[model samples]
Target: MKSTEPVCQYELKAARDAMEVIQGKWRIPIVISLTYGTKRFGEIHRDIPDISPKMLSQELKALEENKLITRTLHDSMPVTVEYALTPLGMSLRELLDELRNWGKHFRGEIVGK
Candidate 1:
């Protein structure tokens, strides 16, 4: 057997790790919406009405832990929080664009819609 596994295990693991960061029902939408600019919890929720509040919060925390998004707290009355993409997250724009294009093409080819 001439190595049935990946040439580099770390690289394979890294790719899987990256996918996990954005893998979910709401993570990609959350990331795409943030491209418009920083937004508060409610603003994000409004932008993606299909996602429930708890799911959104969970995705936000995952993105934050992955260093993909940053959360800021405002010291005003009642305290408001906002989320923005980190440099790593912003750098994903090109990749995201390509993925979006590919998805459209794939859907069109398959569904003819």
Candidate 2:
């Protein structure tokens, strides 16, 4: 079978940086949740039921620090905060879609499901 692209030439530092941001039990799921639209902290937590509030806070900070997501505050009777993906983060849609397809293909091959 022919390969799609040349073997990856990713730099160790660059790869590690990428991993550092998404390195968690919930980051990818969080990203997927945000894919639907910008969301408030509680909304994101509700979407990913398994993540603890503390862990979710930590992960959100990491994502913001890495420029993958933006956090905003709204002033009202009750303050509100929302998070949205940056352009760099939105670029992951293609990669994530590819991963879903590959995972489905691999699972079928391995588990006969």
User: Highest lDDT among the candidates is held by which one?
Assistant: 1
What do the candidate models score in CA lDDT, each in turn?
Answer: 0.91, 0.88
lDDT of 1 by residue, 21-100 (tens): 77877888999999999999999999999998998999999899989999999999999999999999998898789889
Compose the digit string of candidate 2's lDDT tens values, residues 1-113.
Answer: 97797645677678777777777678889898999999999999999998889999999998898888999999976999999999988988987798689999999999994
Give the local distance difference test score of model 1.
0.91
Position 2, candidate 1: lDDT: 75
lDDT of 2 at 62: 84
TM-score of each: 0.85, 0.82
State the TM-score for model 2: 0.82
Question: Alpha-carbon error at 25 in model 1, in Å?
Answer: 1.2
